[model samples]
Target: MQTTISLEIQRYRPEQESEPVYQSYEVPLRKDWVILDALNYIKDNLDGSLSYRWSCRMGVCGSCGMMANGTPVLTCATFLETYAPGPIRVEPLINFPVIRDLIIDMSEFITKLKQMKPWIVREEEQPLSDGEYLQTPDQLTEYKQYSMCINCMLCYAACPIVGLEPGFLGPAAIALAQRYNFDNRDQGKKQRTEILKEDNGIYECTFVGECSIVCPKSVDPAGAIQRYKVAAAAEWWKSLLLPWGNR
Candidate 1:
Protein backbone atom coordinates (compact mmCIF):
# COMPACT_ATOMS: atom_id res chain seq x y z
CA MET A 1 0.00 0.00 0.00
CA GLN A 2 1.17 3.53 -0.80
CA THR A 3 1.68 5.95 2.07
CA THR A 4 -0.28 9.21 2.02
CA ILE A 5 -1.12 12.07 4.39
CA SER A 6 -3.85 14.67 4.52
CA LEU A 7 -3.09 18.38 4.53
CA GLU A 8 -5.84 20.69 5.73
CA ILE A 9 -4.90 24.22 4.76
CA GLN A 10 -6.63 27.42 5.78
CA ARG A 11 -7.35 29.70 2.85
CA TYR A 12 -8.59 33.27 2.64
CA ARG A 13 -9.67 35.15 -0.48
CA PRO A 14 -10.84 38.70 0.03
CA GLU A 15 -12.41 39.02 -3.43
CA GLN A 16 -14.52 35.85 -3.28
CA GLU A 17 -15.05 35.24 0.43
CA SER A 18 -15.48 37.54 3.38
CA GLU A 19 -13.82 35.08 5.75
CA PRO A 20 -11.26 32.29 5.63
CA VAL A 21 -12.02 28.64 4.96
CA TYR A 22 -10.27 25.30 5.02
CA GLN A 23 -9.27 23.17 2.02
CA SER A 24 -7.91 19.66 2.17
CA TYR A 25 -5.57 17.70 -0.05
CA GLU A 26 -3.88 14.32 0.12
CA VAL A 27 -0.27 13.97 -0.98
CA PRO A 28 2.30 11.23 -1.06
CA LEU A 29 4.05 10.85 2.29
CA ARG A 30 7.73 10.53 1.60
CA LYS A 31 10.32 10.20 4.36
CA ASP A 32 12.47 13.04 3.03
CA TRP A 33 9.69 15.51 2.13
CA VAL A 34 9.05 18.59 4.21
CA ILE A 35 5.77 20.52 4.57
CA LEU A 36 6.87 22.86 1.77
CA ASP A 37 7.27 20.00 -0.67
CA ALA A 38 3.75 18.86 0.09
CA LEU A 39 2.49 22.40 -0.56
CA ASN A 40 4.33 22.54 -3.87
CA TYR A 41 2.78 19.27 -4.90
CA ILE A 42 -0.66 20.65 -4.18
CA LYS A 43 0.02 23.84 -6.11
CA ASP A 44 1.53 22.11 -9.14
CA ASN A 45 -0.62 19.03 -9.46
CA LEU A 46 -3.77 19.48 -7.41
CA ASP A 47 -4.92 23.07 -7.14
CA GLY A 48 -3.35 26.01 -8.92
CA SER A 49 -5.60 28.61 -7.27
CA LEU A 50 -4.35 27.82 -3.79
CA SER A 51 -2.00 30.63 -2.77
CA TYR A 52 0.82 31.04 -0.25
CA ARG A 53 4.23 32.68 0.03
CA TRP A 54 7.66 31.02 -0.10
CA SER A 55 11.05 31.98 -1.50
CA CYS A 56 14.18 30.05 -0.60
CA ARG A 57 13.37 26.39 0.01
CA MET A 58 16.18 26.41 2.52
CA GLY A 59 15.67 27.84 6.05
CA VAL A 60 17.80 30.94 5.35
CA CYS A 61 15.12 33.13 3.69
CA GLY A 62 12.53 32.59 6.49
CA SER A 63 9.70 33.30 4.02
CA CYS A 64 7.87 30.05 4.64
CA GLY A 65 6.65 30.58 8.19
CA MET A 66 3.20 29.16 8.91
CA MET A 67 1.13 27.47 11.62
CA ALA A 68 1.54 23.72 11.48
CA ASN A 69 -0.78 21.76 13.76
CA GLY A 70 -1.55 24.96 15.67
CA THR A 71 2.11 25.94 16.20
CA PRO A 72 4.00 28.54 14.19
CA VAL A 73 6.94 26.94 12.38
CA LEU A 74 9.14 27.27 9.33
CA THR A 75 7.61 24.98 6.72
CA CYS A 76 10.92 24.52 4.91
CA ALA A 77 12.47 23.06 8.02
CA THR A 78 9.47 21.12 9.41
CA PHE A 79 9.49 17.65 7.97
CA LEU A 80 6.24 15.81 7.18
CA GLU A 81 7.51 12.65 8.83
CA THR A 82 7.22 14.26 12.24
CA TYR A 83 3.43 14.33 11.99
CA ALA A 84 3.21 10.92 10.36
CA PRO A 85 0.12 8.75 9.96
CA GLY A 86 -2.54 11.46 9.76
CA PRO A 87 -3.84 14.88 8.86
CA ILE A 88 -1.95 18.12 9.48
CA ARG A 89 -3.39 21.59 9.70
CA VAL A 90 -1.52 24.45 8.05
CA GLU A 91 -2.47 28.10 8.19
CA PRO A 92 -1.06 31.61 8.08
CA LEU A 93 0.87 33.02 11.02
CA ILE A 94 -1.54 34.31 13.65
CA ASN A 95 -1.89 37.86 15.08
CA PHE A 96 -1.87 39.59 11.69
CA PRO A 97 -4.30 40.39 8.92
CA VAL A 98 -4.35 37.69 6.28
CA ILE A 99 -3.57 38.95 2.80
CA ARG A 100 -4.52 35.73 1.10
CA ASP A 101 -4.02 32.07 2.05
CA LEU A 102 -0.79 31.84 4.02
CA ILE A 103 0.54 35.38 3.66
CA ILE A 104 -0.09 37.76 6.56
CA ASP A 105 0.15 41.51 6.06
CA MET A 106 3.44 42.57 7.63
CA SER A 107 3.24 46.29 6.90
CA GLU A 108 2.74 47.06 10.60
CA PHE A 109 5.65 44.84 11.56
CA ILE A 110 7.87 46.62 9.01
CA THR A 111 6.80 49.99 10.35
CA LYS A 112 7.64 48.96 13.93
CA LEU A 113 11.02 47.58 12.86
CA LYS A 114 11.76 50.90 11.19
CA GLN A 115 10.72 52.76 14.32
CA MET A 116 13.37 50.84 16.29
CA LYS A 117 16.01 51.79 13.69
CA PRO A 118 17.86 48.45 13.70
CA TRP A 119 21.12 49.84 12.35
CA ILE A 120 24.31 51.36 13.66
CA VAL A 121 23.76 55.03 14.42
CA ARG A 122 26.67 57.40 14.69
CA GLU A 123 26.45 61.07 15.62
CA GLU A 124 28.93 61.84 12.82
CA GLU A 125 30.10 59.84 9.88
CA GLN A 126 33.73 58.68 10.10
CA PRO A 127 36.00 59.33 7.12
CA LEU A 128 36.92 56.34 4.93
CA SER A 129 40.59 57.02 5.62
CA ASP A 130 39.89 56.32 9.31
CA GLY A 131 39.33 52.66 8.39
CA GLU A 132 36.51 50.31 9.42
CA TYR A 133 34.91 50.24 12.85
CA LEU A 134 36.69 47.48 14.71
CA GLN A 135 35.31 45.07 17.29
CA THR A 136 36.87 42.32 19.40
CA PRO A 137 35.45 38.75 19.40
CA ASP A 138 33.88 39.26 22.84
CA GLN A 139 32.12 42.37 21.57
CA LEU A 140 30.89 40.50 18.46
CA THR A 141 29.37 37.79 20.64
CA GLU A 142 27.32 40.34 22.58
CA TYR A 143 24.86 40.97 19.72
CA LYS A 144 25.40 38.04 17.35
CA GLN A 145 22.67 35.82 18.85
CA TYR A 146 19.95 38.43 18.43
CA SER A 147 21.13 39.25 14.89
CA MET A 148 19.86 35.92 13.54
CA CYS A 149 16.24 37.05 13.22
CA ILE A 150 15.08 36.80 9.58
CA ASN A 151 11.81 38.73 10.00
CA CYS A 152 9.79 35.55 9.60
CA MET A 153 7.26 36.88 12.19
CA LEU A 154 6.79 33.49 13.80
CA CYS A 155 7.56 35.18 17.09
CA TYR A 156 4.70 37.59 16.44
CA ALA A 157 2.37 34.70 15.77
CA ALA A 158 3.22 33.01 19.03
CA CYS A 159 3.22 36.11 21.22
CA PRO A 160 0.04 36.56 23.25
CA ILE A 161 0.82 40.21 23.86
CA VAL A 162 0.61 40.87 20.14
CA GLY A 163 -2.78 39.19 19.99
CA LEU A 164 -4.05 41.18 22.98
CA GLU A 165 -2.43 44.49 22.12
CA PRO A 166 -2.23 45.04 18.40
CA GLY A 167 -0.16 48.21 18.69
CA PHE A 168 2.63 46.58 20.67
CA LEU A 169 6.13 46.46 19.13
CA GLY A 170 6.57 42.72 18.62
CA PRO A 171 9.52 40.49 19.57
CA ALA A 172 11.62 40.62 16.42
CA ALA A 173 11.50 44.40 16.34
CA ILE A 174 12.57 44.76 19.98
CA ALA A 175 15.20 42.02 19.65
CA LEU A 176 16.69 43.64 16.58
CA ALA A 177 16.77 46.95 18.40
CA GLN A 178 18.81 45.33 21.16
CA ARG A 179 21.00 43.65 18.56
CA TYR A 180 22.27 47.05 17.44
CA ASN A 181 22.17 48.56 20.91
CA PHE A 182 24.55 45.89 22.19
CA ASP A 183 27.10 46.58 19.47
CA ASN A 184 30.08 48.60 20.74
CA ARG A 185 30.09 50.57 17.47
CA ASP A 186 26.45 51.63 17.75
CA GLN A 187 25.77 55.07 19.22
CA GLY A 188 21.97 55.04 19.04
CA LYS A 189 21.23 53.26 22.30
CA LYS A 190 19.73 56.39 23.83
CA GLN A 191 17.38 56.92 20.90
CA ARG A 192 16.32 53.26 20.84
CA THR A 193 15.78 53.37 24.61
CA GLU A 194 13.30 56.23 24.23
CA ILE A 195 11.40 54.35 21.55
CA LEU A 196 11.29 51.02 23.38
CA LYS A 197 10.27 52.67 26.64
CA GLU A 198 7.02 53.81 25.04
CA ASP A 199 3.66 52.51 26.31
CA ASN A 200 3.20 49.95 23.55
CA GLY A 201 6.79 48.72 23.59
CA ILE A 202 8.65 46.25 25.82
CA TYR A 203 6.48 46.96 28.85
CA GLU A 204 3.46 45.58 27.02
CA CYS A 205 5.01 42.13 26.86
CA THR A 206 3.70 40.02 29.76
CA PHE A 207 6.40 37.44 29.02
CA VAL A 208 4.20 34.49 28.15
CA GLY A 209 7.39 33.33 26.38
CA GLU A 210 5.78 31.66 23.37
CA CYS A 211 7.81 33.88 21.04
CA SER A 212 11.12 32.26 21.98
CA ILE A 213 9.63 28.79 21.76
CA VAL A 214 8.44 29.23 18.18
CA CYS A 215 11.50 30.98 16.77
CA PRO A 216 13.11 28.74 14.16
CA LYS A 217 16.53 30.33 14.57
CA SER A 218 16.49 30.06 18.38
CA VAL A 219 16.97 33.82 18.61
CA ASP A 220 15.61 34.01 22.20
CA PRO A 221 13.84 37.32 21.65
CA ALA A 222 12.18 36.97 25.04
CA GLY A 223 15.55 37.08 26.78
CA ALA A 224 16.62 40.14 24.78
CA ILE A 225 13.44 42.01 25.70
CA GLN A 226 13.95 41.30 29.39
CA ARG A 227 17.57 42.41 29.23
CA TYR A 228 16.48 45.62 27.52
CA LYS A 229 13.96 46.24 30.28
CA VAL A 230 16.73 45.99 32.88
CA ALA A 231 18.83 48.49 30.97
CA ALA A 232 15.89 50.86 30.50
CA ALA A 233 15.09 50.77 34.22
CA ALA A 234 18.72 51.43 35.15
CA GLU A 235 18.83 54.37 32.76
CA TRP A 236 15.64 55.80 34.26
CA TRP A 237 17.10 55.60 37.78
CA LYS A 238 20.36 57.22 36.66
CA SER A 239 18.46 60.06 35.02
CA LEU A 240 16.41 60.64 38.16
CA LEU A 241 19.41 60.59 40.55
CA LEU A 242 21.88 62.60 38.50
CA PRO A 243 19.82 65.19 36.67
CA TRP A 244 22.89 67.47 36.45
CA GLY A 245 24.92 64.90 34.49
CA ASN A 246 24.45 63.74 30.85
CA ARG A 247 22.80 60.38 31.51
Candidate 2:
Protein backbone atom coordinates (compact mmCIF):
# COMPACT_ATOMS: atom_id res chain seq x y z
CA MET A 1 0.00 0.00 0.00
CA GLN A 2 1.26 3.52 -0.83
CA THR A 3 1.74 5.71 2.21
CA THR A 4 0.75 9.35 2.21
CA ILE A 5 0.75 12.31 4.61
CA SER A 6 -1.65 15.23 4.89
CA LEU A 7 -0.41 18.83 4.65
CA GLU A 8 -2.61 21.61 5.91
CA ILE A 9 -1.35 24.72 4.15
CA GLN A 10 -2.60 28.20 4.90
CA ARG A 11 -3.93 30.14 1.93
CA TYR A 12 -4.71 33.83 1.49
CA ARG A 13 -5.88 35.15 -1.88
CA PRO A 14 -7.06 38.74 -1.92
CA GLU A 15 -9.23 38.21 -5.00
CA GLN A 16 -10.94 35.09 -3.71
CA GLU A 17 -10.88 35.36 0.09
CA SER A 18 -10.69 38.26 2.47
CA GLU A 19 -9.12 36.14 5.21
CA PRO A 20 -6.62 33.33 5.35
CA VAL A 21 -7.83 29.72 5.47
CA TYR A 22 -6.37 26.27 5.72
CA GLN A 23 -6.35 23.94 2.74
CA SER A 24 -5.29 20.32 3.02
CA TYR A 25 -3.65 18.12 0.43
CA GLU A 26 -2.30 14.59 0.52
CA VAL A 27 1.07 13.64 -0.94
CA PRO A 28 3.11 10.47 -0.96
CA LEU A 29 5.22 10.09 2.13
CA ARG A 30 8.64 9.14 0.92
CA LYS A 31 11.65 8.63 3.10
CA ASP A 32 13.98 10.83 1.06
CA TRP A 33 11.51 13.58 0.25
CA VAL A 34 11.70 16.91 1.99
CA ILE A 35 8.74 19.21 2.54
CA LEU A 36 9.61 21.05 -0.68
CA ASP A 37 9.14 17.86 -2.65
CA ALA A 38 5.61 17.40 -1.28
CA LEU A 39 4.79 21.02 -2.06
CA ASN A 40 6.09 20.53 -5.59
CA TYR A 41 3.89 17.49 -5.93
CA ILE A 42 0.89 19.53 -4.92
CA LYS A 43 1.78 22.36 -7.32
CA ASP A 44 2.26 19.97 -10.22
CA ASN A 45 -0.34 17.28 -9.63
CA LEU A 46 -2.96 18.50 -7.22
CA ASP A 47 -3.45 22.27 -7.41
CA GLY A 48 -2.19 24.77 -9.93
CA SER A 49 -3.38 27.88 -8.11
CA LEU A 50 -1.03 27.43 -5.13
CA SER A 51 1.63 30.09 -4.64
CA TYR A 52 4.91 29.88 -2.71
CA ARG A 53 8.58 30.77 -3.06
CA TRP A 54 11.35 28.20 -3.36
CA SER A 55 14.83 27.93 -4.86
CA CYS A 56 17.93 25.80 -4.52
CA ARG A 57 16.18 22.79 -3.04
CA MET A 58 19.55 22.06 -1.42
CA GLY A 59 18.83 24.78 1.21
CA VAL A 60 21.37 27.45 0.17
CA CYS A 61 18.94 30.02 -1.25
CA GLY A 62 16.87 30.32 1.93
CA SER A 63 13.72 31.23 -0.03
CA CYS A 64 11.45 28.41 1.17
CA GLY A 65 11.23 29.36 4.82
CA MET A 66 7.80 28.67 6.33
CA MET A 67 6.07 27.70 9.53
CA ALA A 68 6.16 23.94 9.72
CA ASN A 69 4.19 22.41 12.62
CA GLY A 70 4.33 25.72 14.50
CA THR A 71 8.09 26.13 14.04
CA PRO A 72 9.89 28.30 11.50
CA VAL A 73 12.06 26.12 9.28
CA LEU A 74 13.41 25.86 5.76
CA THR A 75 11.14 23.55 3.83
CA CYS A 76 14.05 22.49 1.65
CA ALA A 77 15.87 21.08 4.68
CA THR A 78 12.86 19.62 6.50
CA PHE A 79 12.19 16.00 5.61
CA LEU A 80 8.69 14.54 5.42
CA GLU A 81 9.85 11.30 7.05
CA THR A 82 10.31 13.20 10.27
CA TYR A 83 6.54 13.63 10.55
CA ALA A 84 5.13 10.42 9.08
CA PRO A 85 1.64 9.04 9.14
CA GLY A 86 0.06 12.33 10.13
CA PRO A 87 -0.78 15.87 9.16
CA ILE A 88 1.65 18.80 9.14
CA ARG A 89 0.56 22.41 9.48
CA VAL A 90 2.41 24.67 7.04
CA GLU A 91 1.84 28.41 7.08
CA PRO A 92 3.52 31.58 5.93
CA LEU A 93 5.95 33.16 8.38
CA ILE A 94 4.18 35.03 11.13
CA ASN A 95 4.58 38.70 12.22
CA PHE A 96 4.37 39.95 8.65
CA PRO A 97 1.52 40.93 6.35
CA VAL A 98 0.65 38.09 4.01
CA ILE A 99 0.94 38.85 0.33
CA ARG A 100 -0.67 35.63 -0.79
CA ASP A 101 -0.30 31.94 0.02
CA LEU A 102 3.05 31.38 1.77
CA ILE A 103 4.32 34.83 0.78
CA ILE A 104 4.72 37.73 3.19
CA ASP A 105 5.66 41.37 2.77
CA MET A 106 9.43 41.63 3.22
CA SER A 107 9.63 45.33 2.47
CA GLU A 108 10.06 46.14 6.14
CA PHE A 109 12.82 43.62 6.53
CA ILE A 110 14.60 44.98 3.45
CA THR A 111 14.33 48.51 4.78
CA LYS A 112 15.79 47.46 8.11
CA LEU A 113 18.55 45.62 6.32
CA LYS A 114 19.48 48.78 4.45
CA GLN A 115 19.41 50.80 7.66
CA MET A 116 22.09 48.54 9.15
CA LYS A 117 24.48 49.21 6.25
CA PRO A 118 25.65 45.62 6.21
CA TRP A 119 28.76 46.20 4.17
CA ILE A 120 32.38 47.20 4.39
CA VAL A 121 32.71 50.97 4.81
CA ARG A 122 36.17 52.29 4.58
CA GLU A 123 36.79 56.00 5.13
CA GLU A 124 39.10 56.19 2.13
CA GLU A 125 39.20 53.59 -0.55
CA GLN A 126 42.59 51.99 -1.03
CA PRO A 127 43.86 52.84 -4.47
CA LEU A 128 43.75 49.94 -6.91
CA SER A 129 47.51 50.27 -7.07
CA ASP A 130 47.54 49.40 -3.35
CA GLY A 131 45.91 46.10 -4.27
CA GLU A 132 43.15 44.27 -2.36
CA TYR A 133 43.23 44.54 1.38
CA LEU A 134 44.67 41.43 2.93
CA GLN A 135 43.76 39.78 6.22
CA THR A 136 45.07 36.83 8.20
CA PRO A 137 43.04 33.74 9.01
CA ASP A 138 42.60 34.90 12.60
CA GLN A 139 40.96 38.13 11.42
CA LEU A 140 38.65 36.17 9.13
CA THR A 141 37.67 33.92 12.04
CA GLU A 142 36.50 36.93 14.07
CA TYR A 143 33.37 37.49 11.94
CA LYS A 144 33.02 34.11 10.25
CA GLN A 145 30.22 32.86 12.48
CA TYR A 146 27.91 35.75 11.64
CA SER A 147 28.63 35.44 7.92
CA MET A 148 26.50 32.31 7.52
CA CYS A 149 23.21 34.21 7.46
CA ILE A 150 21.15 33.51 4.34
CA ASN A 151 18.50 36.21 5.05
CA CYS A 152 15.78 33.57 5.23
CA MET A 153 13.78 35.72 7.72
CA LEU A 154 13.16 32.66 9.88
CA CYS A 155 14.69 34.55 12.77
CA TYR A 156 12.25 37.42 12.31
CA ALA A 157 9.29 35.03 12.27
CA ALA A 158 10.53 33.24 15.39
CA CYS A 159 11.39 36.41 17.29
CA PRO A 160 8.83 37.62 19.80
CA ILE A 161 10.49 41.04 19.77
CA VAL A 162 9.58 41.45 16.13
CA GLY A 163 5.99 40.53 16.93
CA LEU A 164 5.83 43.12 19.69
CA GLU A 165 7.84 45.89 18.02
CA PRO A 166 7.63 45.90 14.26
CA GLY A 167 10.18 48.71 14.05
CA PHE A 168 12.82 46.78 15.91
CA LEU A 169 15.93 46.03 13.82
CA GLY A 170 15.37 42.26 14.35
CA PRO A 171 18.08 39.57 14.51
CA ALA A 172 19.56 38.64 11.16
CA ALA A 173 20.08 42.25 10.13
CA ILE A 174 21.92 43.04 13.32
CA ALA A 175 23.99 39.90 12.98
CA LEU A 176 24.97 40.81 9.44
CA ALA A 177 25.91 44.27 10.62
CA GLN A 178 28.08 42.69 13.27
CA ARG A 179 29.73 40.62 10.57
CA TYR A 180 30.97 43.77 8.83
CA ASN A 181 31.71 45.44 12.15
CA PHE A 182 34.02 42.60 13.04
CA ASP A 183 35.75 42.68 9.68
CA ASN A 184 39.28 44.10 9.83
CA ARG A 185 38.91 46.00 6.58
CA ASP A 186 35.68 47.76 7.53
CA GLN A 187 35.56 51.17 9.25
CA GLY A 188 31.86 52.00 9.72
CA LYS A 189 31.32 50.89 13.30
CA LYS A 190 30.69 54.44 14.56
CA GLN A 191 28.06 55.12 11.92
CA ARG A 192 26.29 51.80 12.56
CA THR A 193 26.53 52.32 16.32
CA GLU A 194 24.51 55.55 16.24
CA ILE A 195 21.74 53.93 14.20
CA LEU A 196 21.60 50.81 16.35
CA LYS A 197 21.52 52.95 19.51
CA GLU A 198 18.04 54.19 18.67
CA ASP A 199 15.08 53.45 20.95
CA ASN A 200 13.72 50.76 18.62
CA GLY A 201 17.08 49.08 18.08
CA ILE A 202 18.77 46.31 20.04
CA TYR A 203 17.46 47.74 23.31
CA GLU A 204 13.95 46.60 22.36
CA CYS A 205 14.92 42.94 22.23
CA THR A 206 13.99 40.95 25.34
CA PHE A 207 16.37 38.14 24.41
CA VAL A 208 13.84 35.36 23.89
CA GLY A 209 16.47 33.51 21.78
CA GLU A 210 13.84 32.02 19.46
CA CYS A 211 15.66 33.69 16.56
CA SER A 212 18.80 31.72 17.28
CA ILE A 213 16.82 28.52 17.79
CA VAL A 214 15.22 28.77 14.35
CA CYS A 215 18.33 29.82 12.38
CA PRO A 216 19.17 27.13 9.83
CA LYS A 217 22.74 28.37 9.26
CA SER A 218 23.60 28.50 12.98
CA VAL A 219 24.29 32.22 12.71
CA ASP A 220 23.24 32.73 16.36
CA PRO A 221 21.60 36.13 15.86
CA ALA A 222 20.68 36.31 19.53
CA GLY A 223 24.33 36.07 20.43
CA ALA A 224 25.20 38.71 17.87
CA ILE A 225 22.66 41.13 19.35
CA GLN A 226 24.01 40.54 22.85
CA ARG A 227 27.54 41.13 21.65
CA TYR A 228 26.46 44.35 20.00
CA LYS A 229 24.75 45.47 23.19
CA VAL A 230 27.93 44.92 25.16
CA ALA A 231 30.00 46.73 22.56
CA ALA A 232 27.56 49.62 22.48
CA ALA A 233 27.66 49.87 26.25
CA ALA A 234 31.45 49.99 26.30
CA GLU A 235 31.42 52.74 23.71
CA TRP A 236 28.98 54.68 25.87
CA TRP A 237 31.32 54.43 28.83
CA LYS A 238 34.28 55.50 26.73
CA SER A 239 32.40 58.61 25.67
CA LEU A 240 31.51 59.40 29.27
CA LEU A 241 35.11 59.05 30.45
CA LEU A 242 36.94 60.54 27.45
CA PRO A 243 34.57 63.10 26.04
CA TRP A 244 37.54 64.99 24.58
CA GLY A 245 38.71 61.97 22.57
CA ASN A 246 37.23 60.98 19.25
CA ARG A 247 34.38 58.47 19.75
> CA lDDT of each candidate?
0.93, 0.93
lDDT of 2: 0.93
Backbone collision count in every prediction?
A: 0, 0
Model 1 regions more than 4 Å off:
none
Which lDDT tens digits does candidate 1 get at residues 84-155? 876999999999899999888999999999999989999998999999999999999999999999999999
Q: Write the per-residue lDDT of candidate 2 for residues 1-247, one digit (tens) a residue.
A: 4499999999999999999999999999998999999999999999999999998998789899999999999999999988877699999999989999999889999999999898899999999999999999999999999999999999999998899888899999999999999999999988887989878888888899999999999999999999999988888898899999885
TM-score of each: 0.97, 0.98
Those runs of model 2 whose alpha carbons end farther than 4 Å from true positions after fitting are none
Cα deviation in Å at residue 145, candidate 1? Answer: 0.4
